[model samples]
Target: MPTEPEPQRPPVGPAPARHELDAERLRAALVRGADPDAFYRRLDVVTETASTNADLLAAARDPGTDRRVLLAEFQHGGRGRHSRGWAGVPRAQVIVSVLLRMPGIDLADLGWLPLLAGTATVDAIRSVTGVDAELKWPNDVLVGGRKVAGILAEVAGTHPEPVVVVGIGLNVSLTEDELPVPTATSLALAGATDLDRTALAEALLRELARRWQQWYVAGWDVTGPAAAYRERCGTLGRRVRAVLPGDTELHGVAADIDEQGRIVITPDDGGEPIAVSAGDITHLRPVP
Candidate 1:
C-alpha cells in the first residue's frame, strides 16, 4: 500500500541582512531644518544600548538633561508596561526615548504621557508607511488588531521640575517569524512599502514633537490629546475586561476615557461604571 510521504516541513530560507542605521544621514536630516527652540534640543543615535529608557531616565535626574532625544539601533533590555520584556532587531525598529521636564503637569495626568506616545506612534506609522495603526488603550499600538508598538513612560525626577522619559518601540521591518509574539505584527508583515529606518524615525519624532508641544503648551491640558486619542483608540466602544494589579478583573463595555486618561468601563450587568488608572485590558467585542 502506498503511504503519503511523511508530512514535510516547509523549506527554510536564509534570513535577510540586518540593516544598520545611518546616524550621519539621520543627523544631517534632523539638522537641515532644525528649530533652534524646538522641544528636542539634541538628538543622538547609538548603535546599541542596554535600554534607552533607562539611559534617559538616568539623564533626567540632571535638570540640564531635559529636551534630549536618544535613539538606539537595538535595545537589549527594552521593557514595556508592567516590566514586560522587549528587544528589537538591529535597526529594524525605531527604539527611541525622549526626556522632558514635566512643566507643571498635575501628577494625576501623567498617565497621558504613554497614551500620547501611542497616539503619536500610530500617526507616525500611518504618515511614513501608509499603514493604518490604532491604539490599544494606554500603551500598545496596533495594525489590524495586532500589536505593532509598545510605549513606556517613566517618571524620573520630582522636585522643582519632574522629568519623564517616554520610550517608544515600534516594529518596522520585523518579519512574521520575528514578531515578539503570535499576537504581534510589524509594518513589514503588514505590507508597508516604506521601511527605511531614517524616514520612520523622522516621522515618529516629528509626530511626537508636534503632539508633545501642544500638550506642553496647554500646561498638560488633556482636552486636545484626549479627543485625538479617543478618536484613534480601538478599545473604546468595545467590550473589554480590565485587569487591575493583583489579578483583579472587571468585565464591562469601554465607555469613555476620563480626564486623567483612565478607561471608564461600564459593567453590562447594570453595575456602576468604574475607571481604571492602570491595568491590562483585553478587547472582547464591539459594543452594539
Candidate 2:
C-alpha cells in the first residue's frame, strides 16, 4: 500500500500571550443547562488552536460528527474579515466558534451571519457586564468607540454539504498593552470589573443559539438583528466615509441597514440611499 500524505494545515500566526482560564470548568458550567445540547453539541476545549473557526470547520466536516461548538482559551492564529490578524492574551478573552448546518440558506446570505452574531454578542455583553457595547458595521463590536470584539463567519462543505461556522473573539480582561491597534479596548478597561469568563461564555453561547435559531427559522430575516444592531450601532446617522469593494471612497450619512443587511447611506452629494454590501467605514463627524 502506498503511504498516505499528511494533511496540510493553515499557517500558524503569533500566539496570544498565555493566561489561565479553566476550559474544563467552563464546559461543565455550560453542560449543566437543561438545553445544553441546543447550544453546544460538545464543548471541545483546547489550550491553543490556530483558530477556533478552523477547528469548528474541521469538526463540521468530520464524517460521523454532528454540528459542534469550539471553545478555546487561547488561539495562536485568530483571523478576522479580509484575513486580518488579531491576537489576545490567553484566558483574557472569549474565543468561541459555533458550527451550524444551514442547508437551506443561500451562499450569498452567509455574508450577513457575522452581523447576526455581532448583534447577539452585543446583547449578551450588555446583559452580563452592564456596559454599553456598540457595533461598527459588518462585524466589529466596540465599547465607547473602541474595538472590544470581532466576528468572522466561514462556510465549508459545498453544494449538497453546506455548513457555516461563526467565530467570535472578545477582549474580556485584555489590558491596554495587548491591543494591537490604538482604537481597540477591553471590557475590564471600560470598568467592567469582576470579569467572569465562564459565565460570559455561557451567556454568549446561549444568546447566539437563540438568535441563530430565530434567524434560521425566520429565513435569515435581517429585520430583527438589524433593528437591534441599529440601536447599538455607533455608525448609524453619522457622517462617515466608506471604502467600497473596488477601493473607491464615498462620503455619506449612514442612514440604516436595510432588511437584507445592506448598508444604506445617503451621499453628501445628494443622491438616493446607496446600498453597500461590503466596505470599511470611518466616522467623519456627527450627523447634522
Candidate 3:
C-alpha cells in the first residue's frame, strides 16, 4: 500500500489584518451549540480596539452597560498576567476579555479564575490546532516549550457586586520576527499550521464558558478541574525563581499548587517552605 502524503502548510508569516467580517458570517460562525441570544448579547467585536479587558472593565463599571463580552481583532495596549505589555498580530491573534458578575464572593477566592481560563483555552487550542499545549505555573500556555497563549484575570469593585474580567491573548499565526520574545511561539510556529483566529477565539470562549459554569456550580474543590489543572501545570516539581514585590526573591523547586491554588515552593537552600500568593515564576528549565 502507498503512504498518503502530508498536507503542505503555508509558510510562517503574519496573517493579514482584516478590518471586519461580514455580520452574517460572524453570526453563523459564533452560533455553534450556543444559546441563540447568548452569542448576540455578549458579542462585542471591534477591528482595532485597544484592549478588550480595558473595554470590559469600563463597561462593567457603568451602571447602564450590561455585563458582556469583548473581542478585538488587535489590541494596541494589551496586557498580560503581571501588567506586561503584549503585541497582537492583528487578525492572527485573539484578544478576548470576558466580564462576569460575582456577587457576595470574597475578592481573594477569585485568584483561581485565571487558571481556569488558561485550562479552558488549552482545551480549545488542542481541539482546533491538534496540539497538546501545557500551562505554565499560574496561567501561560506553551506549545513545544514555547509560550503560545496567556490569561490575565482582574477584579474590579469591592464586595456586594464585584466584576471579574478575564483577558486571553493567543498567538494563532505570527511570524518569528513579529513574536515579541524568542521563547514565545504561535499555533503555526509549532507545527500546528491549521490556525484560524476567529475559530480559535470562539472555541476558547465556548470552552471557557463551560469551565466557568462548572466552577461556579462546584464552588472551589481540590478535585475536579483544579486537580486537572495540576496535571498539565508545567511548573510542578521544577526548579524555579520567583520575584515578589519590593524586590524580594525566592529560589526553589515548585512543589505543587495547594488546594487553594497557591503555589507551594520548597526553597533550594533547604530552609523553609513558602507559598507565593502572587508573583512572577521563572521555571529554570524549558517546558519538558
Candidate 4:
C-alpha cells in the first residue's frame, strides 16, 4: 500500500502582474500581417531611455539606418513641441519614434510632416479607443479638449539624405493623480476599455505609414493631408491666442490652416489675417 506517495508541491508566490505591452509580443504583432517591405523596417522596444527620438535620431546619422522604429516602456526625458518635457508610467503608454530618410521629397513640404503625424495620431486614437481625438494645430492630439498624445518631429540629419525623426507619446492607463497636468488625460481615464499598447502602437504605425506613402507619392502635396487635418482639427473656427516667438502675442479667430500648414488667424482687432508658422495656441473662452 506504499505505492501512493504524497506528491511534493512547489511553493507559489503572488501572480506576476500583466503588462500592456510585452516587448516580444509587441514586436511580433507589429510585423505580423504587415507587408514585408513596410516602412517600419525595424522595431525596437527598450526598457527605458532619455528619449526614443534621441535614440532614433542618433541611429539615423548612420545613413544606413532608415525606417527604424524605437519604442520605450518608459521615458524619463521625453519631450514635446517647444521643448516641453513629457513623462508617463512604465508600460502604461505608447512612446515611439520613427526614422525616415526622405531624399526626393521637397524640403518645402517638410512643414507638413508634423501635421501629418497629428492626423495619423487622431485617426489611430479614434479607431482604437473610440475617442473623438482631434488635432491642435501642428502636433497636439486632444480628446474631449484634453491632451492625450503629443507629437514631435525633428530633422535628425541632412548631409547625404534628409533624415527626419518623428516621435509620438500617448498616455494609456494613467490614473487621475498620475496626470502631469489638469489638461492632460489618458485613454483609460477617457473611458477606453481596451488599453492594449500593442494594438494601439500597431494602429498608429500603420496609419503613419499610409499617410507617409500618400504624402510621398503626391510629391509632398499638402492638399489631401491638409484637408484631412482640417476636418479633425478643433482649433480652427475657435477663438484663440497665439503666443508668438519672442513673447509677441496675437489674439484672433483660427480661420484656417493654409496650404503651407501655417495657422491663418483673423485678428480680433480687425487686422489682416496673419499666418502663424510657429506659436503656442491657447483656446479662448467666449466672453459672456
**Per-residue C-alpha lDDT of model 4 across residues 12-33, encoded as one tens digit per residue:** 3322232856666655655533
Poorly placed runs, candidate 3 (over 4 Å): 1-40, 63-67, 220-223, 285-288
Task: Supply candidate 3's per-residue lDDT for 33.
Answer: 37
Model 1, total clashes: 0
Instruction: List the pairs of residues colliding in candidate 2.
Output: none
lDDT of 2 at 67: 50
What RMSD, rounded to one decimal, does every model reach? 6.1, 10.3, 6.6, 12.7
Predicted candidate 2 versus true structure: per-residue lDDT over 34-111, tens digit per residue:
345555657777778889988777776674554577877778888888898876567888899888777677776677
Off by over 4 Å in 1: 1-18, 29-34, 286-288
Evaluated at residue 248, the lDDT of candidate 3 is 87
**Tens-digit lDDT track of model 1 for 86-145:** 778887788999887877888778888888888888888888899989998887998877
Q: Rate the local accuracy (lDDT) of all candidates.
A: 0.81, 0.77, 0.74, 0.82
Number of clashing residue pairs, candidate 3: 0
Best by lDDT: 4
Clashing pairs in 3: none
TM-score of each: 0.90, 0.86, 0.85, 0.90
Candidate 2 TM-score versus the reference? 0.86
Better of 1 and 2 by lDDT: 1
